[model samples]
Target: MFDYLGGNFPTIDRRSKKQMKDVEMVAQLLLFLEEGVRAYSQEYLDKAFSDRDISWDAKEEVEKEFCNTVKAIKEILDLSQDINLSKTRLKNQADFYSLFGAIAELNRENEKLTITRDIGVRINNFLKLVGDTELKNQSKDSLTDYQRNALEYYEAVKFSFTDAGTRKTRIRIMKSVIRGNIN
Candidate 1:
């Protein structure tokens, strides 16, 4: 959506249809990457243990790179440029692929963090359920605040990512959002 451009660029309706389509494709790709980063960041907040131990600076650096890449792509689409539409399309596609490669690397880094956090959460939950269950049952004391919070967060994250139906629904929503069909 052009709204994401933060008013940095003018309206694109005056461009040729082919150029418009190329710009739209670039916009959709950028939107998808933005959403992916946001979703992963939220999951990180919810599920991460020892968050201080993780280096989150890499995420910030990648985000800056993404912004710069988007800006460059937009500049290429500027109407004042004398380049032909076909040449612009080729350049845009090249830039898109470059951005895609950067996105892939960022995703790999995020996946590592997610996998580590998931393992830690699962282990903590398992220990509490098995080893602490008897103690909890024998005593009148309810689950500790920490235990309750961790379990709730773990369940939420697990259900969000593990269910086939949920995954399909999320995919549908993502597609619509990227296509600018959803607000």
Candidate 2:
């Protein structure tokens, strides 16, 4: 895991090759983060729908929230500052620290985005399972058969991120669910 405890975050002051390497690592990390969010969102959906006790309206709300959250995150990333290793700062620790903080935050956002995406995935999965199980047990024709299940299960499970927040609860999704349980 990347260490953000000592505050040695990803910054532009690092060596050219090292900075490039960090950028690549950050990109790959983002990919995993993105995939994880999508996966977990479906997982949440699956749980909510399969349980039968939860209302469809509630599931819909989760889905809506997931969608909106994803949109907002994407917008933030698009509008956020880009990491520029080209601007070398050899003597300025403050500049390096600021750059490091920016990189760290960007990376953190990727992780959060992944989690929110997974929440949507979970909700979706719950819906699918509910529909499948209901049909199987009731002898009723399903809207979607087991063989014909169309919901694509996004398989994106990734490790979580951890950090200390001053007087704030560290709500990391991969470690635990930030939201309330479906039941």
Best by lDDT: 1
Q: What would the per-residue lDDT of candidate 2 be over residues 50-101, giving only the tens digit for each residue? A: 6635444444544444344434433322342242221222012222222223
TM for candidate 2 is: 0.23
Residues 29-131, model 1: lDDT tens digits: 4434444423323344334323524755445655665565454434433432343222321233322243343334434445421122322233233324423
Give per-model TM-scores: 0.23, 0.23
Each prediction's whole-model lDDT (CA): 0.37, 0.31
Q: In candidate 1, which residue pairs get closer than 3 Å at backbone N, Cα or C atoms, i.e. clash?
A: none
Name the lDDT value of residue 161 in candidate 2.
Answer: 18
As for model 1, its CA RMSD to the true structure in angstroms is 20.4
